[model samples]
Target: MRITTETVAAAMKSALPNKTKYHFDDDLAGFGFYRTTTGTGTFFAEFRTVAGGSKKRLKLGRVGTLKANEAREAARKAIANAALGKDLAKSRAEGRAAATVARLLELYNERTRDKRKASTADGYDLIAKVNIVPHIGATKAAAVTRQEVQRMHGKVGKARGHYAANRAVAVLKAAYAWGGKHGHVPEGFNPASGVDRYREEPRERFLTDAEMIAIGDAMTEAETIGLAVDAGTAKHAPVGQRVVMSPYATAAVRLIMLTGARLREILHLRWDEVDLERGILRLPDSKTGKKLVYLPTAAIDIIKGLTPIGAFVIAGESAGTKREKPRADLKKPWAAILKRAGVSGIRIHDLRHTFASIGVGDQMGLPVIGALLGHSNAATTKRYAHAADEVQRRAVEAIGGKIAAALGGVK
Candidate 1:
């Protein structure tokens, strides 16, 4: 029977239960309405591709939403397009294949898992979770415009500061590049490219001699009185209870100051990495790759005094019946030490700067200091050139005074 307003209305009202009924239009082939047992009806278009592909069914809309005349017109156009070599089914599939930003990030993470270090991978993942995913994760990779990325960069910079904003942009750039390379995004499309990165000055925070002494004294006092209770099982101490620092935490802090190593480099140091016979640390992997850290006698003494608890030098509290893993972080103990020393507005990394400052004051050249600090680039060592200039000034003054004295103090 022909599908018209009368027939469609009749079908909707009298369609049998637990059965589906199809009413084909005598006027147009493959244009029809199928009524389900529950009296719900939908108009659909069915056609084969010009290349003689299998028949495909495209749902136009529900009976109430689309009249029979509108459905027939849509079906006519669909059939015409199919005959003109357009594959509607394939087009729909390609639309689904356009990956979202979240999907691209996942692919990027998987691609770099083996190549990137655990810390580096964690940093990238954090940028995605904290910055990118929260804002534009659902947007299609190809649909993310450069203007959107620039706006996000600006917003993050205003809210969090330039450094964090630059980092977020860098992570997005890398992810988009990876997505493009892997065909997850459109070829030659990168929304993060060509955006200007904010200018960032190198930050150096060096500790003064008195500050170092105060910190040392505080750390000593902390170790002497601090408890090493198992955090997993121990009850919370009273509000006013005097808490002590962990021996491992104290040693780690001191080692960072003495050795000029990064916090992670010290915390992640293993027993196998220490060379007591040569008084050096042979790190197989570091930020600057393989490095040999020469230990001063004081630093060696600290290392010698530490009792190994697990694989790491700074081992965490043991889990029930299982060996403990490396300590995850030193936030609490570092805070306590800083508070006791009455020091504020300093980071653990500043201890490294302090070590460099001392070397500079001792008249060591920048090249030598750079080598000791495992700096891969001379440009990085150039930050200490001003300290060397101070030494040069003192040397020139002393020589000029001696010359004047030799000339019978003429001036």
Candidate 2:
């Protein structure tokens, strides 16, 4: 029957609840309506590929959504294109194969697993998970534009911070570069390119002597009370009760303050990494790569006091268990310590700065302090130069005052 408005209306009204049926147009080939047993009708185009290949069907719209004439015109164009050697089905499949941001991130992680450290890889994964993926993970890699990248960068900067924004953009840049190199993204298509990055000032916060003493007192009090008790333990109270910091955590904090090592460096410190006889810590890997941290007597004593619970000098709660893993973070205990000490606006990393500050105040040479702190180069250690200058200025003022007193008595 001819596929006119009347014919389609009749098919819709009389369609049976048995099986699907097709009503092709009498004037146009391959244009029709598929009537389902539920009385629903849809327009579709049926065409062959390469004149002798398999038939392909493309759904256009529902009967009410598309008129018979419009469906016929669309089907005619589709059939004509099919006859001209285009494979509409294959093209659809290729469109589905186009790379998305999520897919590109997965590929980037896999490719850089060996090239990046576990900590570095974790940072990248965090940037993708917490920042980039939530914003545009579903967007096609090839379709991402510089405008979208800039907007994301700006929004992240406003919401998080400028430094975090810069890091997030760096992650995006690396992902796009990796994708483009591997042909996952189009050549010369880097959305992150030319997007301005936020300028970040170096943030250096050192603990004052009073703040340091207060924190030490807090840690001591914490140790006496014990850190939070383990859950499901009848021997102790429930979680959230003030308990001592695990001996490991207590000793770890002391060492960081005494030695100026990074938090992760101390948390991940293994028994094999310590050299007690030489008073040195031979770090096999660090932010600046391999380094040797020269430990003073105080630092060495702190390390000696710690009783190794597992392979790690600072063991987590899983110590001595089959599922034991080294302490990966110190967020909870550190937060509690900070609260109890009444200390604000100081971070765990600030302990390192405090150590450098004290060294400079004691008239320790910058080069010597740099070596003790395991600085990779002089430039990285230059931040402490002002502390040394302050010390020298005080010495000169004392000497000049005595000389001036003697000249006044002679006059």
**CA lDDT scores, all candidates in order:** 0.82, 0.82
Q: Where is model 1 more than 4 Å wrong at Cα?
A: 1-98, 138-151, 154-160, 194-196, 226-238, 317-325, 409-411
TM-score for each of the candidates: 0.69, 0.70
lDDT of 2 by residue, 1-411 (tens): 888888889778883858899888888888888998878788888888775777888676678868888988878887888889776656654553587888888889888878988879987888888778878889987788889888888888888789878888898989888765544665457889899998888878888888888888888887887545445332555666756666677788888998889998898888999999999888898888888877889889888887777778888888768888778777767777777788987878888988998999999999988887888888888898889999999999888888988889632
Clash number for each model? 1, 4
Give me the displacement of residue 54 in model 1, in angstroms: 15
Question: What tens digits encode model 1's per-residue C-alpha lDDT throughout 1-411?
Answer: 788888888878883758887778998898898988878788888899866678998666679868888989988988888988787656754753677888888778878888878778877888788778777889887799888888888888888789988998888898888665444665458889998889999887888888899899889988997634444324677555556767889999989998999888898788999998999999888898999989989999998898887778876776222665667678878877787788987889888888898899899889899999999999998888888888989999999999999999478
Q: For candidate 2, give the lDDT.
A: 0.82
Question: Any runs in candidate 2 off by more than 4 Å, and if so which?
Answer: 1-97, 158-160, 226-240, 318-324, 409-411
lDDT for residue 368 in candidate 1, whole number 0-100? 92
**How many Å off is the CA of 175 in candidate 1?**
0.7
Task: Give me the overall lDDT of model 1.
Answer: 0.82
RMSD of each: 16.5, 17.1
